[model samples]
Target: AQTIHQWPVAEIKAVGSPLSLGCTIKGKSSPNLYWYWQATGGTLQQLFYSITVGQVESVVQLNLSASRPKDDQFILSTEKLLLSHSGFYLCAWSPGQYQDTQYFGPGTRLLVL
Candidate 1:
Protein backbone atom coordinates (compact mmCIF):
# COMPACT_ATOMS: atom_id res chain seq x y z
CA ALA A 1 0.00 0.00 0.00
CA GLN A 2 1.12 3.55 -0.67
CA THR A 3 0.89 6.34 1.84
CA ILE A 4 1.89 9.96 2.20
CA HIS A 5 3.09 11.75 5.33
CA GLN A 6 3.51 15.45 6.03
CA TRP A 7 5.34 17.00 8.94
CA PRO A 8 4.47 19.76 11.40
CA VAL A 9 0.70 19.45 11.03
CA ALA A 10 0.42 23.08 12.14
CA GLU A 11 2.86 25.94 12.31
CA ILE A 12 2.83 29.53 13.53
CA LYS A 13 5.46 31.71 11.97
CA ALA A 14 6.29 35.36 11.94
CA VAL A 15 6.05 37.27 8.73
CA GLY A 16 9.29 37.40 6.71
CA SER A 17 10.79 34.42 8.54
CA PRO A 18 12.13 31.21 7.13
CA LEU A 19 9.88 28.21 6.73
CA SER A 20 10.32 24.54 5.97
CA LEU A 21 7.79 21.75 5.42
CA GLY A 22 8.18 18.15 4.36
CA CYS A 23 6.33 15.34 2.61
CA THR A 24 7.15 11.75 1.91
CA ILE A 25 5.48 8.99 -0.09
CA LYS A 26 6.06 5.33 0.53
CA GLY A 27 5.44 2.09 -1.38
CA LYS A 28 5.08 3.76 -4.74
CA SER A 29 7.62 3.94 -7.51
CA SER A 30 8.25 7.08 -9.49
CA PRO A 31 5.00 8.64 -8.48
CA ASN A 32 4.11 12.16 -9.52
CA LEU A 33 4.49 14.56 -6.60
CA TYR A 34 2.64 17.82 -6.15
CA TRP A 35 2.49 20.71 -3.68
CA TYR A 36 -0.69 22.66 -3.14
CA TRP A 37 -1.69 25.56 -0.93
CA GLN A 38 -5.00 26.96 0.19
CA ALA A 39 -5.32 30.42 1.63
CA THR A 40 -7.74 31.25 4.38
CA GLY A 41 -11.17 30.33 3.03
CA GLY A 42 -9.67 30.21 -0.46
CA THR A 43 -9.55 27.44 -2.98
CA LEU A 44 -6.55 25.20 -3.33
CA GLN A 45 -3.77 26.20 -5.71
CA GLN A 46 -1.05 24.10 -7.16
CA LEU A 47 2.37 25.32 -6.06
CA PHE A 48 4.76 22.84 -7.62
CA TYR A 49 5.01 19.37 -9.14
CA SER A 50 7.60 16.87 -10.22
CA ILE A 51 7.44 14.03 -12.68
CA THR A 52 10.83 12.55 -11.85
CA VAL A 53 13.69 12.87 -9.47
CA GLY A 54 15.50 16.20 -9.67
CA GLN A 55 12.93 17.59 -12.10
CA VAL A 56 10.45 19.98 -10.56
CA GLU A 57 8.11 22.45 -12.21
CA SER A 58 6.27 25.38 -10.77
CA VAL A 59 2.57 25.46 -11.25
CA VAL A 60 2.06 28.63 -9.25
CA GLN A 61 5.05 30.17 -7.57
CA LEU A 62 3.45 32.28 -4.90
CA ASN A 63 6.60 33.22 -2.98
CA LEU A 64 7.53 29.60 -2.27
CA SER A 65 9.70 26.89 -3.75
CA ALA A 66 9.78 23.08 -3.78
CA SER A 67 12.31 20.39 -4.44
CA ARG A 68 12.28 16.63 -5.01
CA PRO A 69 15.55 15.34 -3.71
CA LYS A 70 14.68 11.65 -3.60
CA ASP A 71 12.35 9.25 -5.31
CA ASP A 72 9.90 9.38 -2.42
CA GLN A 73 10.50 12.68 -0.68
CA PHE A 74 9.55 16.25 -1.51
CA ILE A 75 10.31 19.46 0.36
CA LEU A 76 8.69 22.90 0.49
CA SER A 77 10.55 25.83 1.92
CA THR A 78 11.17 29.56 1.77
CA GLU A 79 13.61 32.12 3.06
CA LYS A 80 10.66 34.30 3.93
CA LEU A 81 7.01 33.47 4.35
CA LEU A 82 4.65 36.34 3.83
CA LEU A 83 1.39 36.89 5.63
CA SER A 84 -0.21 35.98 2.34
CA HIS A 85 1.56 32.67 2.61
CA SER A 86 -0.46 31.67 5.58
CA GLY A 87 -2.69 28.76 4.61
CA PHE A 88 -3.00 25.00 4.34
CA TYR A 89 -0.27 23.16 2.51
CA LEU A 90 -0.89 19.73 1.03
CA CYS A 91 1.35 17.09 -0.44
CA ALA A 92 -0.12 14.72 -2.96
CA TRP A 93 0.89 12.00 -5.36
CA SER A 94 -0.42 9.78 -8.14
CA PRO A 95 0.82 7.09 -10.39
CA GLY A 96 3.25 8.60 -12.84
CA GLN A 97 1.60 6.86 -15.75
CA TYR A 98 -1.87 7.96 -14.70
CA GLN A 99 -2.06 11.72 -14.49
CA ASP A 100 -5.76 11.96 -13.90
CA THR A 101 -6.27 11.09 -10.24
CA GLN A 102 -4.19 12.25 -7.32
CA TYR A 103 -4.41 11.35 -3.64
CA PHE A 104 -3.61 13.77 -0.84
CA GLY A 105 -2.53 13.07 2.68
CA PRO A 106 -3.08 15.05 5.87
CA GLY A 107 -1.89 18.62 5.24
CA THR A 108 0.08 21.19 7.18
CA ARG A 109 -1.75 24.40 7.99
CA LEU A 110 0.39 27.43 8.72
CA LEU A 111 -0.63 30.67 10.35
CA VAL A 112 1.50 33.73 9.77
CA LEU A 113 1.79 36.32 12.47
Candidate 2:
Protein backbone atom coordinates (compact mmCIF):
# COMPACT_ATOMS: atom_id res chain seq x y z
CA ALA A 1 0.00 0.00 0.00
CA GLN A 2 1.19 3.52 -0.70
CA THR A 3 1.39 6.14 2.01
CA ILE A 4 1.83 9.88 1.79
CA HIS A 5 3.08 12.07 4.60
CA GLN A 6 2.87 15.82 5.08
CA TRP A 7 4.78 17.83 7.65
CA PRO A 8 3.60 20.44 10.12
CA VAL A 9 0.00 19.38 10.40
CA ALA A 10 -0.96 23.02 10.83
CA GLU A 11 0.51 26.49 11.17
CA ILE A 12 -0.38 30.05 12.06
CA LYS A 13 1.91 32.76 10.79
CA ALA A 14 2.22 36.47 10.33
CA VAL A 15 2.52 38.14 6.98
CA GLY A 16 6.07 38.17 5.54
CA SER A 17 7.12 35.16 7.60
CA PRO A 18 8.94 32.41 5.84
CA LEU A 19 6.96 29.22 5.32
CA SER A 20 7.84 25.70 4.35
CA LEU A 21 5.77 22.54 3.95
CA GLY A 22 6.80 19.06 2.91
CA CYS A 23 5.36 15.81 1.64
CA THR A 24 6.77 12.32 1.32
CA ILE A 25 5.41 9.16 -0.23
CA LYS A 26 6.26 5.61 0.71
CA GLY A 27 5.60 2.27 -0.96
CA LYS A 28 5.47 3.83 -4.38
CA SER A 29 8.16 4.26 -6.98
CA SER A 30 8.46 7.41 -9.03
CA PRO A 31 4.93 8.51 -8.44
CA ASN A 32 3.70 11.86 -9.71
CA LEU A 33 3.06 14.64 -7.22
CA TYR A 34 0.56 17.48 -7.31
CA TRP A 35 0.07 20.39 -4.98
CA TYR A 36 -3.22 22.08 -4.24
CA TRP A 37 -4.42 25.06 -2.27
CA GLN A 38 -7.82 26.12 -0.96
CA ALA A 39 -8.64 29.45 0.58
CA THR A 40 -10.99 29.80 3.47
CA GLY A 41 -14.41 28.77 2.14
CA GLY A 42 -13.06 28.83 -1.38
CA THR A 43 -12.72 26.25 -4.07
CA LEU A 44 -9.62 24.12 -4.51
CA GLN A 45 -6.90 25.20 -6.88
CA GLN A 46 -4.09 23.26 -8.45
CA LEU A 47 -0.82 24.97 -7.72
CA PHE A 48 1.80 22.82 -9.38
CA TYR A 49 2.92 19.28 -10.05
CA SER A 50 6.02 17.15 -10.39
CA ILE A 51 6.49 14.12 -12.56
CA THR A 52 10.09 13.38 -11.69
CA VAL A 53 12.80 14.37 -9.32
CA GLY A 54 13.96 17.94 -9.91
CA GLN A 55 11.22 18.55 -12.44
CA VAL A 56 8.28 20.71 -11.45
CA GLU A 57 5.50 22.37 -13.39
CA SER A 58 3.42 25.32 -12.34
CA VAL A 59 -0.26 25.58 -13.09
CA VAL A 60 -0.89 28.97 -11.54
CA GLN A 61 1.04 31.95 -10.24
CA LEU A 62 0.43 31.72 -6.52
CA ASN A 63 3.76 33.37 -5.62
CA LEU A 64 4.81 30.06 -4.02
CA SER A 65 7.32 27.54 -5.24
CA ALA A 66 7.58 23.76 -5.22
CA SER A 67 10.51 21.37 -5.49
CA ARG A 68 11.01 17.65 -5.76
CA PRO A 69 14.52 16.94 -4.58
CA LYS A 70 14.10 13.21 -4.07
CA ASP A 71 11.96 10.66 -5.83
CA ASP A 72 9.66 10.42 -2.87
CA GLN A 73 9.90 13.93 -1.52
CA PHE A 74 8.04 17.10 -2.49
CA ILE A 75 8.35 20.48 -0.85
CA LEU A 76 6.43 23.76 -0.87
CA SER A 77 7.90 26.95 0.42
CA THR A 78 7.91 30.71 0.23
CA GLU A 79 10.22 33.45 1.48
CA LYS A 80 7.35 35.65 2.61
CA LEU A 81 3.87 34.64 3.61
CA LEU A 82 0.83 36.67 2.62
CA LEU A 83 -2.50 36.79 4.32
CA SER A 84 -4.00 35.43 1.15
CA HIS A 85 -1.85 32.36 1.65
CA SER A 86 -3.89 31.22 4.60
CA GLY A 87 -5.60 28.01 3.65
CA PHE A 88 -5.17 24.27 3.26
CA TYR A 89 -2.27 22.81 1.35
CA LEU A 90 -2.60 19.34 -0.07
CA CYS A 91 -0.09 16.92 -1.53
CA ALA A 92 -1.31 14.22 -3.82
CA TRP A 93 0.27 11.35 -5.71
CA SER A 94 -0.80 9.39 -8.75
CA PRO A 95 0.49 6.05 -9.89
CA GLY A 96 2.14 7.12 -13.14
CA GLN A 97 -0.27 9.34 -15.01
CA TYR A 98 -2.61 12.23 -14.45
CA GLN A 99 -5.55 10.14 -15.48
CA ASP A 100 -5.10 7.92 -12.48
CA THR A 101 -6.76 8.67 -9.20
CA GLN A 102 -4.63 10.78 -6.90
CA TYR A 103 -4.04 9.78 -3.34
CA PHE A 104 -3.74 12.73 -0.99
CA GLY A 105 -1.79 13.19 2.21
CA PRO A 106 -3.11 14.46 5.50
CA GLY A 107 -2.57 18.05 4.33
CA THR A 108 -1.20 21.15 6.02
CA ARG A 109 -3.40 23.95 7.25
CA LEU A 110 -1.99 27.46 7.34
CA LEU A 111 -3.54 30.60 8.76
CA VAL A 112 -1.50 33.63 7.80
CA LEU A 113 -2.25 36.73 9.72
Q: What TM-score does each of the candidates earn?
A: 0.95, 0.95
Model 2's alpha-carbon lDDT is 0.94
lDDT of 2 at 95: 94
Off by over 4 Å in 2: 97-99
Residue 19 in model 1: lDDT: 96
**Candidate 2 local lDDT, 1-113, one digit each (tens):** 99999999999999999999999999999999999998878888999999999999999998899999999999999999998899999999999855678888999999999
RMSD (Cα, Å) for all candidates, in order, is 0.9, 1.1
Residue-level lDDT tens digits of model 1 in 1-113: 99999998999999999999999999999999999998778888999999999999998868888999999999999999899988999999989785659999799999999
The residue ranges of model 1 lying beyond 4 angstroms of the native Cα positions read: none
Error of 1 at 42 (Å): 2.4
- TM-score for candidate 2: 0.95
